[model samples]
Target: MLLTRTNPVIKPRTLTSIHEQLRDHGVNLFHTQMHEREAFKAMFSFGGTLETLDRAQVNNIDKAILNARDFASEVVDILKAAQNAEGEGAHLAATSAPMTSSKVA
Candidate 1:
């Protein structure tokens, strides 16, 4: 199986696919960055150094990692946007909306 991380945009399905690639690596980088990430490291089944996995798989995982990074970028954007939307005046802090309109006018 090959995973490509080239595209920055993602559909939810792609997130699901990336989750699948985690196999034992956990859902995202929060668990995969090191040898003992609580979620992914222990479950990682590969027996040797990263060199042991097929080149294509490694590259694919790299791409998937890129995808995850992109996802984090999107989340930051969403959070900032949400925070901005909740702000009204200089003094008031961001407040949760009871309901948010889809079309900003």
Candidate 2:
């Protein structure tokens, strides 16, 4: 639920916000690792064949998905924190920009 893409723009904006937040925090490893991990998951976890998987295989896949829910929850928590901080930062930036710019001029 961290991604509310009801509006098409929200997803990209969220991603940009996350990247900016990470950059501001001087952490590239988290973002890079997450991207690579997602790519690996998509490459390996997908079953593209028409042949049906066996019962145990199906159960295993189901279990993997269930276990991933915990990971998803953790990712959501991280995203939420980043989003909350980004919102606060934006508010502060807006309020301070004019004053700072006038002082600079």
Could you report the Cα RMSD, in angstroms, for every candidate shown?
Answer: 14.5, 14.5
lDDT of 2 by residue, 8-82 (tens): 223467677876786788764332122212222433565432133344444344434434465567777788999
Task: Pull out the clashing pairs in model 2.
Answer: none
lDDT of 1 by residue, 70-93 (tens): 556766776787787666542353
Model 2 weakest 10-residue run by lDDT: 31-40
lDDT of each: 0.47, 0.49
For candidate 1, the 10 contiguous residues with the lowest summed lDDT are 34-43
- Candidate 2: residue 34 Cα off by (Å): 13
* Native-to-model Cα distance after best TM-score fit, residue 83 in candidate 1, in Å: 1.0
- Best candidate, TM-score-wise? 2
Alpha-carbon shift of residue 32 in model 1 (angstroms): 19
